[model samples]
Target chain A: MCRMCDWLGEGQIWYKNPKLHANRMYKLREPGRKPQESLRGNIVGSNLHEALEAKANGDLATFNRLIAEKNAADARKVGAQPIPLNEAIEVIKTLQMPVAAMMCICRKATRAEEETNLNEYSCLALGTGMFKWERWPERYRGGVEFLKPQDACDWLEYWDKRGMMHLIMEEGNDFLGGICNCDYPDCNPIRQRVDYGLDQQLVKGEYICEVDFKRCNGCGECLGRCHFNALKFEVTIDRPSIDPMVCFGCALCQTACNRGAINLVPRSAYPALRNVW
Target chain B: MNVVINPKITVDYERCTTPFDCKRCIRICPPAVFVVYDIESHRGYEVDKKQPGTYKMLPLYRDKCTGCMKCVEVCPVDALTVKMPEEMLT
Candidate 1:
């Protein structure tokens, strides 16, 4: 955030002459004219079938963790270094890579097409905790002066040793490998309209992050943190009204769960709004 | 030059937030005046060119106008209120 603030402080938000009354040029291209960006899918350069089978058979457990382990291992074998996440973020912005959630593994996430049935799993990490990673001390040690191009590769190298830095998917694909991780929400090939608040999800959410009703301790830590006006006391079925449109999927609610009641499951982004994709 | 929408002047709309980085407000204005940007929205105030050349005033005033509301019919979101030394409303 500090670095982003610095970038913002430099008066650079793609939009020129942001001040009111200033006549500036419009750079937003039409949808078709917009650059070609593929959505991410569960397509890594690894054996996804076995991984999924293990998950289905209760051997691997959550698909997210398995995908991370595999990607980390492969990244290490190929000598991919951890580019300072902050620097990597900067590079993604500079180079304009098409990614979602900064940490999207290339092939595990993508856009939902109007046609074609896909067994693919597209998940974005939406990890707010990683902001702490961006502020990690070691990343800024080199300073931009020494943040050379080679250092970019070294950054990926460092990344290979860690856990899945972004959203990971364990599945199949046709083009663009099974791993698309990095940044650039619009073009990251790993994100979709829903990842960056572009889908029909602008309406109120239905399936909100919830806790096991049985495990409710009645603590209200999550109430203040919730940006949306959802969340209710546990008494009847009125637990929390999840307005998905407002939920950025930051998972702070789950983090605050003292009784392990908050669990994120597939729920309607909004009830009234029809799914466009 | 600055595009002044005097609080007394007429503007098309209070403002328009065209989403993402839509500089529609800038494109519509005649003067190459700078619009201020809000800290979060990244849209708003610009230079008060009527005075000494420097950044001043509500730096984030632009984000306030969403280019919607009825006010836009008269005051365009691109409208600016330039305060000349003499015309400066005390």
Candidate 2:
């Protein structure tokens, strides 16, 4: 379980519980206060877009300035926490409410050419948020199809098996927004955090991967599954070595390993990495 | 937003004979600037004894291109060419 879930998943995972979410939503909107209005405030996305433009033009000064500003802005705003796949599954199954699959907006924007033929319905929105989804027409584009808990689990597992990282987000800083099935190259949060040195959008998972050399066969399967570039084969040792610092604790490597040599040790166990996120 | 940078990616369509079969640029690009676009009529590439519908690569998010050139480096067929901005050249 992730630190966020461990701290928040008491009687009911704080965000998924309908009553708590309703309270949060009411607080956010509060009887006609500009409709709560995205809470994202527009700066983060705009700064990021500008930063990308700068980076593309090879304007290091501009890119660095924009990225720093964006990071600073993200640091001030409280937001979603990254949970491991297991915790994500637990949250979805326990919600006991309607879950819906929607097209991945990131994939659609970046990989437009592949949109027509690809099944980009990898983002899962949970809780009662679906009931009034029409309120946010932009988010509900192409509409949402309901999924049974079992089907939801299957869908999440399918994405996990395909090496997608599961990210549980808090909408408007409080509501359990949804779970995004993300990939390294296309997912904005992942790309920004991993490649651009921004850590505010998503926190690290609560566990870290450790490989036991004794029972290990260096088949190199787990190496490819790591999006953080944390896993690599030590050519001399002919075994996979994981860099703890770079590991997001997503445990995709553990799932990929057929040898059972990989384990997800609680991040708390390693004092140095406990607050690394 | 008409933004700071727009990368020029030239795809040698004639040389890019079988793009779907060889999506090096699409797979390797970190920014995901390249994507597969469907060509209605099946004009190229054969699969399972049939000419499957052809797909072409397009630089969909040209503004997002960071000029890392992973696509250029990865394309085995040498069909992709990238021209970074002058500022980027420095």
Candidate 3:
């Protein structure tokens, strides 16, 4: 287990703890309470937008200042944790709550750019959030459907096949709220953290991917699967090289590799990346 | 709470076809202002069954719209009419 599983994991590897996420729907489902975003998700999205705008305007001073303030502010907000898709499914099975797939507003805003019948139902809202979702009519517009845990797993696996990484989010850092299956540029959190140089809300996964070069073929398939720009093709080795500091340990590369050459080691195992995140 | 901007987009339900097939407007709006609305039920695609006025595009995020008009340009049915916020025109 990595430091996250050690610190937040609370001896149960965080995601494995039922009590850490027990009756989330019960607590969040009070009548007429506003559907709210976790402070971190809200702040990071807006901060990244502003910072990017600043950079676009060639205002490096403003961009640097904004990023610094946002970073400090992020440390104080509630956490928006990033768990690998495989572990996220395990968390879903443990929670055993009703799951509903929702349209991804981030992708709708960023990548899809408009609306298309792309059939990309990439966001998963869990627990009471799914029930009281109508409280936020604007967000629940595309609609949501309940899924059996098994079906949810299958759906996520399908997205995985399509190269999406999953991250579980806690609304306001209290209630277990969503499972966002996302890719680069389209995902608000990933885009902010990766492109904006403002790393606050989203944390890296507990593990980092390591490549065993002996069995590896230099096919370069895993390079595109990485959203974090962690994977690179080493010209000398002619194989994929992973920069552990930049890796999120989502293991999309491992799954993408047909040769079984990649593996995830606990991030804590490396002194450099252990405290980097 | 989510914020909405000033946008007035109307769709010619009679001409536009999303329930049975086409969804160009829904696919093209950047702010996701357009959602599939069931006129007969006054609800959205949240329901399982498709109704008679099963799929007409409605402006759900009219406030979030930046008046890009990409949807207006992309709609094949020529069913969408968009009004920009007055301030945007200025």
Candidate 4:
């Protein structure tokens, strides 16, 4: 289990808990207190040029200090954890708040691609935040499409079939906000973690995928689905091997497997991986 | 220790008036280092991208830049400039 589970799970995985989603729907503002800025807004305002410059100049101390400072400040803000498709649907089914399918901001920012059509929206916005998304025009451009729980599940399945990893995002401390269906360098959080070694922004899931060699064939269908490079085809054995440590438990490879050779087991089952997150 | 150098990217907002309409820098950069965003949107309201100067290009992830110069070459107005440190030439 991850630290989020320890803090907000209330004896269950944090994302799986319905109460967290319910509480985040409408946070009552304290009387006479100013409203805080959103995490995405804060991220946009932050200047990472100095840290990147230090990194370029081979100044490890300065780079580490700057990154650490930024991470510490963002520790209480938005963060995400990869969740399997079924669990993601389960979260949607259980939540009472509105679920809206919105254009992926990461895709727009990283690739300059726009999902103008309703069917093309790849990100799901949870809770009441979707109601007032017009406030953040840059982030919520092209508007949003509200979905029924059943439709949301089907939409999640569609993205799963398309080989996108499902990640549940926390808006504030212990407040569940959205579900992101994205992959690789195109996804901001994934890119930050994989390319820049910024792990705090996203954590591994509650499960780890394992390969069932008995039913396996070297079809190589599942190899390309892995964004983390955790799955490697063993040429000698003619089977795919999974590096348990590298797997985020998104189950994209598992879904892609035609032979049903891949299975996800609880991370707690392995003592070494129990606290890896 | 081996010395490393990175490209310093700058976009002259004056030379580049309409960034939303012309996204050459955003599209050409292989690393997707450049982002075109609305300046007024930060103030908590939507701004029309059709209005010139409302949107601007920013090199948000300069660390990821490989000094490819693709963005600079692709810029129609020649507003982008990528300069490497002089130490790298020594």
* Best-matching candidate per DockQ: 4
Of 2 and 3, the candidate ranking higher by DockQ: 2
Return the top candidate by TM-score.
4
Q: Looking at model 2 chain A, report the run of 10 residues with the lowest lDDT sum.
A: A109-118
lDDT digits (tens) for residues A167-202 of candidate 2:
877765456778898877777678778766677677
TM-score of chain B of each: 0.25, 0.78, 0.69, 0.80
Reference contact recovery of candidate 2: 0.27
Scored against the native two-chain complex, candidate 4 gets a DockQ of 0.39
Write candidate 1's Cα lDDT for B1-90 as tens digits: 223222222332333332113333333333212232222311222222222312121211221122232323333344444332234334
Task: Mark the regions of model 2 whose C-alpha exceeds 4 Å error after superposition.
Answer: A1-45, A56-58, A113-120, B1-31, B34-82, B85-90
C-alpha RMSD in Å of predicted model 2 compared with the true structure: 8.3
Q: What does the interface RMSD come to for each candidate?
A: 22.6, 10.9, 10.3, 3.1
Worst 10 residues of 4 chain A by lDDT: A36-45
Q: Tens digit of lDDT per residue, candidate 4, span A77-142?
A: 556889999899998888767899988888876666668767899999888777887776467766
For each candidate, what TM-score against the reference? 0.27, 0.70, 0.69, 0.85
Model 1 Cα displacement at A80 (Å)? 25
**What TM-score does candidate 2 get on C-alpha atoms?**
0.70
Candidate 1: segments with Cα more than 4 A from true spot? A1-208, A232-241, A244-246, A268-277, B1-90
lDDT of 1 by residue, A1-277 (tens): 1111122224331111122101111223344443323223233564443544343334535444655655544332211111222333343334321222222222211111111111122222111222333354321111111123344334433442222222122111111111223332212322222222222112222123556667756666555544333454545664644454444343445555667777664333344332311
Each candidate: RMSD: 22.5, 8.3, 8.9, 4.5
Q: What are the per-residue Cα lDDT tens digits for candidate 4 across B16-87?
A: 877777777887778778776666655444566667798777787776677778988888889999987666
